[model samples]
Target chain A: MKKHRLLTALAVVALIGLLGVFNLTFDSYKLRILNLCGIYIILGLSMNLINGFTGLFSLGHAGFMAVGAYVSALLTMSPELKDTVFYAVPIHPFVKAMSAPFPIALLLGGIAAGIVGGVIAAPILRLKDDYLAIATLGFSEIIRVVATNLQSITNGPLGLKGIDRVVNTGWSWGLAILTVYFIKKLMDGSYGKAILAIREDEIAAEAMGVNLFRHKMYSFIIGAFFAGIGGGLLAHMLGTIDPLMFRFILTFNILLIVVLGGIGSITGTVISACVVTSMMEVLRFLEGKMDFGFFQIQGIPGMRMVVFSALLMIVILWYPRGLMGTKEFNWDYILQRKYLNIFNKKKKKKTVSEEN
Target chain B: MTILNVDNITMQFGGIKAVSDLKMEINEREIVGLIGPNGAGKTTAFNMITGVYKPTLGNVYFNDKNITGIKPHEITKLGIARTFQNIRLFKELSVLDNVLIANHLRLKSGIVASIVKTPNYKKEERHIYEKSLQLLEDVGLLDLINERADNLPYGKQRRLEIARALATEPKLLLLDEPAAGMNPQESLELMEFIREIRDKYEIAILMIEHHMQVIMGVCEKIYVLDYGITIAEGSPENIQNNPKVIEAYLGVD
Candidate 1:
């Protein structure tokens, strides 16, 4: 166990060093993709915590993300910038003069999303399975509609722009690493077991003294918190976001990341998040015109989604348990095996020598 | 002292009565067996007692406290834990984790402490881990502590359920069909294990079983249920020889 702890610490340090290298080497375009990947990691991990670990099928990521993005963007925008951006309809007086530091704004944004999640969870958590999914989907739609119609606060359909681009690889991936660490720590303890038990068998979990509603709320709220932070990061990274940007398609992308990665596996989510985010960007060309040597082909605008949908289906069919299922990857597992092999070899040599 | 009392409890699902007018009591450190033919509502009676279902009539008392209509988790927290009839182990979790989850009820650390991994929480977590290991050892699953519950053989899975229930430190443990899938020798060992647990832990045990050997071997008293009604209740010897039990098993001539 001591060796395992030391190995884990080393692994974390190595990961941080690798992130530092990526930050130093990547160009702005490449850094943008990396930043997106980091945000997706946060989004994917948070969604997995609710849908995978806690066994609650929620589809409210877009709603929570919207809350976070709007909150953070509104808070960090300067008073002058806010007025100029809401030129069609003057910005809300209360928020016009209000601005906070980047980190504080991100926190408030996450808390705002958590508060919204709690409110929605109160009534919707009672619904089970498909019904819960439908209700959360409806809630996300509601949030989008509100954001679109609330002209004074959200700048209406034109969307908020001229926001500060404070998010880079450091901020995005830094938060992602922090999010993963926090989730891992939580899952390594009794609290994590209680929630996972709910996923295994609700009745047996209840019989063993797991409070269903409380644990569900814990997973949901915490998941929302990280998701909100991810949304805030995305908004600051792009310096522009509208209600349209947080459509169900946004949540669907994160869901794809979660499902393809494996439901309850954090490492799986991290790997798949990186792969899926890059794949999405790479697939963008499929939606544009193709210039052949002789003839040019008109691109299909929605072909990217069609291909992605097909890919998701094929992946699910090929690996139903997902890339990792509920398993986690730890360096200790490999080290443990190596140690066992060495010990067995030593024992075999000792017995051979004794016989000789 | 009476550890559990089901006083005239009845459970109705729609028009059908699952358990009707059921009255049972368990004393400290006593092993009581509830036997019934298929659809005789033995599991239903267990469910009502453990707060899985609200009794349509009458009350359930745990240590003289009225606990009728309480939630299952609340009942468990109030010192009553139960294993399922079909063996409901957390299949994806390790055996150690299965028992660790059951120890959740005993944890006094708040969620913040659990998330933060404070010294108090870490200490409690280590204590729970050690205790879970001890419980698994007592159940003879120490060697497979890290194995996933789903990977265990049928007999070992049943044993895991018992270990998990014991981790909750319940005053009364309810076992439902614990010997269903076990062979004769394994069942014999299970009987001894059950008896040993009752004596060692000082917990009252109420188990529903179809295996007559297990019931007769371990239970000091037995209750026979036929069609949601108790046909006989007495010492195991008396229950075995009772005419009603024979008729309930073999049907009236």
Candidate 2:
């Protein structure tokens, strides 16, 4: 166990060091993609905490992301920038002059989202499964509609521009690694087990002395918080914000990552986030015209989504549990051969038997 | 001392009365049996007492505290724990994890402490792990602690359910159809196991069962119900010989 812990620590440090080196070597475009990968990791892992760990089929992530994005963008933009951006109606007097460092602004954004998440959970948590999903989806739409109409605060449907480009590999990926570390710690504890128990069976969990509503609320709020941070990072990364940017399609994209990675596995979420984000960028080539020597063909604009949709269908049909199921990628799994032989291969048998 | 008092609990689902005016009392370390035909509301009574359903009338008391209308989790924390009739284990969790989850209510650490994993939190977790191991040992499932609850055999699953219930440190334990799918041999073992749990924990146990041999072998007192009403309540022998109980089970000619 001691050796395993040491190895895990070394692996984390090594990963961070490698990312640090990449920060210096990569150009802006490559760096931006890497940062987006980290942001998606945060979003995917947060979504997994609620949908995968607590078994709450929530779809309010886009709304929470909007809250984070708006809060952080509003906080970090200078009063002069805000006035210029909101020239038609003028920015809110209270927030126009407010600005903070990127980290603190991001944190405030997460807190704002968490507050919204908590408030929404009170009413919608009574609904279960698909009903909960629909209610949250409706809530996300409401947020977007509100953001579109609120000209003074959000600059209406025109959106806000001239925001600072403050996101970087260090901050974004640093937060991502921190997110994975802290959430993994939380899940390894008693409170984590309580939520997992709820996912397994709510009634049985309650009967076992787990408070259903409280635990669900905890996961929801925490998930919303990190998702907000991810949104804040994206806003700063892109140097602009808009209501259209946080539509249900955004939630759907992150949901794809969570599901494709295996819902409950953090390691799966991390790996799948990187793969899906990179794949999205790579698929951008399909959006423009294509040349085939003699004949030229016009590329379908939304063909990337078509291909992604097909992939999603195939994944769901072929491997509903996704790449990892509920199994986490940890040192125990990596050193399985050594551990397996010592346990007379019970671990191997267990892994094989429970995969389905 | 009486551990539980169900005083005239009446549960009405719209026009239908599932359990009407049911009253029962269980003292400390006692084993009581509730047997009934299908839809007779034995489980309904259990639900009311465990705070799964709010009684339409009357009160449920745990250790003289009026616990009626409280949430199920609060009732559990107030020292009443229960198992489902259909064996509701945390299927994907390891057997040890299932028991550890039950120990959640007993932790001294709050949400932040648990999330942050403070030194005190680690100590509490170690304590829970040790206690859970002992719990598995008592239930004869120590060897299978690392195995998933869903992977356990039918009998072991039932036992794990009981062990999980016991992890909550309940003053009153409610077992619903514990021997429902068991063979005679397993049923006999369950009877002994139930007795051992009652004696060892010094807890009042109220179980719903259809197995006559298991109920008769284990219960000191038996309550018989039919069509949401109690037919008889007496010592096991008295209940066995009661004509109303016999009619309720075998039907009147």
Candidate 3:
């Protein structure tokens, strides 16, 4: 049953990829939107790994993403001296190879993020929910604060620019699919069960022989790795970068996606990321388009966030479980009634023979 | 052969000594009971031996290795597993998944292998699931495999905890207050279940129980403890009649 569900999920993902590829166009704006969706998918999946699967309350995802964005930008740049790859730690030859091209760069960005995540998580992951949230939130702020201050490497507050724009919609969608697939494989595995076990009860999981610290660290690192890769992809799409872009507000935006999408459900995250991404675009038109009696107001970006945060609050109040609430896609969910009949008939035959 | 030796272990909470210099040993395939009044440090001894708490002063030896301060998971991997005093099953997970998670340390695949879905990983994952199912069936919880553990009846929940601990394939099983909430009929049924599992698995059982009916019924030999000290150690009949055991349970005559 597990095998069948996994194969069908893979097939559905491949079909979506084929459809997106066939419908591809030359317009940079549409391409950019698709690419952004992919990045959000990675961010959503990464957040799911930490908060959804591992049950750690982390608000510092943007910190790891910033780390990924900076490092990946440094590695993938064309080696010009102007605020680009200067005094750069000699990235191993293989790392440059892995990240130079569009697709490999996302993976490299994720791995680099994973390394940073491991380091940050080592000291603070041991903390409980609220403490972890504070620690992770502080970590993200520290990354942004330090990035803004250090003029030598990140050009201080101005940020790195002229990064090669290699990330296209195809790469974005492909990596998004890969992220979803990899997360699917994990949440269905023995380790996934172990993590869910930890989430349900930590003391019980330990007595059951699950190494809680190991599982906790694994989930955080993986989550951070993907968050970093997502940031890297986002940087490439923009074709320009600044430390100010990855603020705490950005972290909260991703948090909104994970919470609304249903914490543990990958399918829920993909759909919600697309929906949330488009909501931002539609809300932008409200600034100048709507006329007030006394004042004509252009759509301010901050207004949209106020609305988003309110909606996020409403969703949490309404559905406390956050979408799926530990439910995984099973064969029953995927199978149509006609196909289910096939299995039912076979089971009936076995039962009849046993009675005879 | 001696599978576990609790040598002069003491457990203290602040100023309260829960178990003071308690000593016990269990050979392979033995069924021993730790019984006394409600707060006689019976569970405390089991907790110290299982690495839930570091002994105030003494050591725990399992298979000749000093396992006093090892982490709970390490102790489990070293062939010891336990159930909680108050039925601490992973409540939100399915009954089957609860056992399957317990069996994780036995799986051949590691993190990378599981994520990559290699051929070996598939085979190993299948093996672990099958083994988990078998353990559930042994505990007669196969039908409720898909149900959430917290939804189970009190008696079934206790059985599920035991099945889960068994899934770790421990050489010694420590059950703390297994029959704490059961009535007479249910408690009697649990008595049979405990003995049957011990006989079937060929594993030693060390239990901390307040129920005399279960202690007298299931244990081959028993140890009585009070104020962190062992008061009596003998066969079931001897323990039931001993002055220290009686006084500990009731009061000085």
Please, what are the lDDT tens digits per residue for candidate 2 over residues B58-111? 999888999999999999998999999999999999999999999999898988
Q: After superposition, how far is residue B76 of candidate 1 from its true place, in Å?
A: 0.5
Per-residue alpha-carbon lDDT of model 1 for A169-246, expressed as tens digits?
789888988999899988888999999999999999999999998999999999898889999999999999998999
Candidate models: Cα lDDT each = 0.92, 0.91, 0.83
> What TM-score do all the candidates reach, one by one?
0.94, 0.96, 0.90
By DockQ: ranked, best first:
2, 1, 3
- State the local distance difference test value for candidate 2: 0.91
Q: Give me the displacement of residue B68 in model 1, in angstroms.
A: 0.6
Comparing 1 and 2 on DockQ, the stronger one? 2
Candidate 2 or 3, higher DockQ?
2
- Better-scoring candidate (lDDT), 1 or 3: 1
For model 3, how does the per-residue alpha-carbon lDDT over B69-90 read when each residue is reduced to its tens digit? 9998899999999998988888
Which candidate wins on DockQ? Answer: 2
Off by over 4 Å in 2: A293-296, A338-356
Candidate 2's residue-wise lDDT over A1-356, tens digit each? 89988998898889989998989899988888999999999999999999999999999899999999999999988888888888788777887878898889999999999999999998889999999999999998999999999898999898879778978888888899999987898899999999999999999998888989989999999999998998898999998889999999999999999999998999889999999999998999989899989998797799889989999898889889877788897686668867667797787788899995
